[model samples]
Target: EYGRDNGIRLSAVWLTHDPEYPENLPAAPLVRYGWTPRGELAVVYDRSGKQVRSFTYDDKYRGRMVAHRHTGRPEIRYRYDSDGRVTEQLNPAGLSYTYQYEKDRITIT
Candidate 1:
């Protein structure tokens, strides 16, 4: 919906096999979506076409995303507290910065 609302066109292609794990056997039609004026997003599916994993956009412009992970939970690169303020963020180098918010001030640790 973000893409459609923001006028970003989305196109998809089907692949006969998993590009990341070519040796592991699975049925066909791995759907990959290309965001025009941006980049591509791919989804992995089981033999029944049920979504096994989906690439999630990290921002409104869809310019960045969490890297694809075949196993385990995706890492939390950005975190928000109950009030919706960002509590933590991890950079590409895997370093994490903590955020502290108060009624009138914000602090980073």
Candidate 2:
């Protein structure tokens, strides 16, 4: 509720606790949020303060995600239409997948 009021929405959360591990082990949790004001996803960071992933939004508020990588470049991207539908996606291998939307159906190519 507080997040929504601040124009941010919680999308997902991950928590980890290893009971069998040593007590000195560090905790690693992740949280993701979406910026509601401009309809973009805010960056998610790990407990160590390193960026986990980030997102971009189109003019109409459609979102595209770019996952972080330890090395090389982030290798996933998406494009959306004005109606907030995903129109295309690019994978790590650089393969492009296109989407087609019809009044009653959606087709992926």
Please give each candidate's TM-score. Answer: 0.33, 0.51
Instruction: Give the winner by TM-score.
Output: 2
Those runs of model 2 whose alpha carbons end farther than 4 Å from true positions after fitting are 1-8, 11-18, 22-39, 62-71, 91-93, 102-105
Backbone clash count, each prediction separately: 0, 0
* CA lDDT, candidate 2, residue 9: 61
- Residue 102 lDDT in model 1? 83
Off by over 4 Å in 1: 1-76
- Per-residue lDDT of 22-108 in model 2, one digit per residue for the tens? 465554445444353555566666556666655555453334443323324555677768766778887777677999999999999
RMSD of every candidate to native, in Å, equals: 10.6, 5.3
- Report the backbone clash tally of model 2: 0
Error of 2 at 68 (Å): 8.9
Candidate 1 lDDT over residue span 1-109, tens digit each: 1113245544333444666888774444344343433554555555455655655455653545534444355544666676666787765556678999889999998
* Pairs that collide, model 2: none
